[model samples]
Structures are given as structure tokens and as C-alpha cells.
Target: MTSTVYAPHDHHTCITAALANAKTLCESRGARLTPVRRRVLELVWQNHKPTGAYELLPQLAQDGFNSAPPTVYRALDFLLELGLIHRISSLNAFIGCAHPGQEHTTGFFICRLCGNALELSPERMQDVNTRLAEELGIVIEEQTIELSGLCPSCQLAATTAKEDIA
Candidate 1:
């Protein structure tokens, strides 16, 4: 498991590990992580913040890659297909999946202030799925529970700002 996104840690290691996992997974699946796709993954892993396709356009353009909307969209879609990334529907942004090779319950806690997101994949989520499926008698295809609020740092900042005004 990776370190909590809220905690301070060596983030370069996160990017490195994610890339290695993606490569291994692609090799196993007989799929390729092409240049644009790889770069897009790298950019998404730059931080815990969710990345929008448009936000990546200029970055890719600066690196002499085609920054067309379709190119980036296709790359993002490809990564999503390989389970290398997750899309935040509310934000219309994408984040790197901590667990890349498994079919697991997924959720996200997005910071309203900073837009940083922490992925949550708790075992209990599976229980919830089970209850819903068994009780409601319906099959569960996919689901994501998203909660939004200020992160710890943002909460502290808001409190301090309030105190300063008093």
C-alpha cells in the first residue's frame, strides 16, 4: 500500500512505483503504454491533485508532443481502460490508481480547497456492495463513493484565518 496522500512523504517514489507497475501490467496484458499515454500518466502522477485533460494539453505541447484534445483524450481513455487511472466525474479530472492491477472497490476523498484527492479502497466497501446486491437482488457493475471537504491543512488554515480576524 502507498502512503496516505495527506501525509508528507517522498512523492517521487510514488510516481516511480506507479510507472513500473503500469509497465509490468501492460506487458502482462499484451498492451502497450505508448509515448503520449506514458507521458499523460507521468503528468497525472505529478501530484495527488486530479488532472483535467485540458490542463495536460499545454504541458504536452511544451514537451513537443501533439496536444490536440483528441490525442490527450485517447491517452486518458487508454489509461482508464488499463485500470491505471480513475476518473473523478464531478471534477471531470483523473487520478492515478493506487492499486493498478486488481478489481477492487474504489472511492475518493477530494479536498474542496486544494483539489487534491485521496483514494480510498476499504474492504468494508465490498460489504456494502454485497448488502446492496443481496438485499436489492441486483448486480453491481461498478461504483465509486466520493466525498468532498477541506483537507487537514486547509481546515487549519481556515481556522487560523478566522482567529486572525477576531
Candidate 2:
């Protein structure tokens, strides 16, 4: 079964692991993870929800960072280049990558009700991409699939509300 971000889990542990993995990957790649870049990454992993640059500006400002548009943009660009984060084009927001130090296409299942985003596993992603390539006869270059709908919890709530009213 695919893991859902909305499902209860130890998010603190997930965040810690992701950060550590990023640090290790950066060090091995000889990338300088500056203080601002590190903090921006931390904020991106603050929750399961994808965050927009504007949403992060105030937080950075409160933390005494420059919080300017260029600063945030540069950090975001660096993270994207390093594959540390994924941008949800549909929502204009960014989310921390669940898996780092690997090259794999990511598929996002975004919850419309709660705005939570979950990354599909690499295995599942590969299967889907393979199918698409075979069916379309096109070589895939870049992939970022974004699907939006109600999550399981939201579906249950909607059903319960309907039953109650009926």
C-alpha cells in the first residue's frame, strides 16, 4: 500500500532523517550547505504540507534572516538543483523530498481538503513511467506528476457528513 502523508506517523523522526540524509549527500557532492540554505530546508520539512516562498518569508524574517525574495529564490534554486525538494507546479509550493541521494521521478498526490502532499515511491513511479513511455512511444526527460483529490480521511468525513444530513 502507498504511504499517505495524512496518516499518523512520527513526523519528527522523518524530518530528522531527511535532514541528515541531505547533509550527508551534500557533503559527498562537495556542495556547501550554507546556514541560510540549511534553515530553508528545515523549514521546508517543517510539516507534510508544501510551502510557498511567501509563506516562508515571514518565518525566515522572524528568525533574523534576510527574508528577501532573491534570498529565498536562490535557496530554492539550490535545493532544486540538489534534488532536495520538489516543486508542486499546480500549487506553486515546495515540499521536501522523502528520498534523497537518488535519482527518481516523483509523483505527488495532493489532498485538496488539507493541502497535504505525499510522494509516491520510486518503484511505483518507475512502473507508471514505463507504462506511459510504452503507451506514448516517447522518451521521458523530466517527470513531476501532480494529482489532486480528497484524501482518505477527507473522503470519510464527507461520507459521514452526508450520512448525518440524510
Candidate 3:
């Protein structure tokens, strides 16, 4: 599915729903969505950009939260554990999951030009996985689908620049 991140929209709703989902997910798992964790999640969802742990430190400190690397790492790990967020291994950054709350196959698309990220739907990823497995007869033990390319907006910008120069 196309990401609204590259488009103009009411982003506040994204953060709001993410926070609420984190709360419910924590409650169901008998876990606490502590202030630090919540804040970390907030930071991740502040935009569609993939945020590095280091990038979050100053913000956390500015907000009066513990800015220690360990503290931030722990919060990130907790969010990852609960599937509230995902680690973009290629960029070593984190972004909030679009559809969290259960186990599902997913693919992440990162815009190489802008550094923004988006979570592709599980159904799409599942279809690929099922088709490959059924056709190849191989066990799917672990996988990470990270596609890097220019996003729609960036593609438009690049094309416009070329056209203007010509």
C-alpha cells in the first residue's frame, strides 16, 4: 500500500492512535507503557522518518526524560518486543509499526532519497511468503524484507528537476 507519509495529511491522528494502541497492547501483555517507553514511541511516531537511537537522545533529555544510551536502548527494545515499533536494520533506526498487536509478516520500504519509512501490509508480505514457500519447498525460519528506493514524492521531485533543466 502507498504511504501517506509522503503526502500531506493530519499526522496527529497517527501519533494518537499509536499511543493508544501501545497502551492496549501493554495492558494485554501485563506490561507497563512507562513514560519513557511512551515517549520513545511518541518520538518514533512523530514522523514517518526512521529515527536513530542517538537522534532521540537530545529530544528525550530536552523533555526531562533519562537520555542515557542504556535507557533509550531499553525503551526501544521494549517497543520492539511488543511490536509497537520496528528496527530498520539497514539504517539502524526505528519507526512505529502501522499495524501492530499481533504476529504478522511485513515488509518495510525506506525511501533512499528522503530517509522516510513505511510498513507494507502483512497480507502483501504473506502472499509473497506463501507463494515462495509453496513453490520452493523451503522452511521460512527468518527473514527481513527491507526495500530501499525513492518514494513517490521523491520520484516526482526528481522528475520535475530533470524536466526543468531540460
Maximum-TM-score candidate: 3
For candidate 3, give the lDDT of residue 40: 95
Q: Give the per-residue Cα lDDT of candidate 1 at 1.
A: 30
| lDDT per residue as tens, model 1, 20-76 | 999999999999999889999999999999999999999999999999999999999
Report the alpha-carbon TM-score of model 3 versus the true structure: 0.95
lDDT of 2 by residue, 19-120 (tens): 887789899999998888998999998888899998889999999999999999999999998989989998899999887767888898988888888988
Among residues 3 or more apart in sequence or in different chains, the pairs in candidate 1 whose N, CA or C atoms overlap within 3 Å are none
- In model 3, pairs of residues that clash are none
The per-candidate count of clashes, in order, stands at 0, 0, 0
Worst lDDT run of 10 residues, candidate 3, spans 1-10
Which residues of candidate 3, in runs, are more than 4 Å off? Answer: 1-3
lDDT of candidate 2? Answer: 0.87
Better of 1 and 3 by TM-score: 3
Between candidates 2 and 3, the one scoring higher on TM-score is 3
Q: Where's the lowest-lDDT run of ten residues in candidate 1?
A: 1-10
Whole-model lDDT values for every prediction: 0.90, 0.87, 0.90
Candidate 3 local Cα displacement, residue 13, angstroms: 0.7
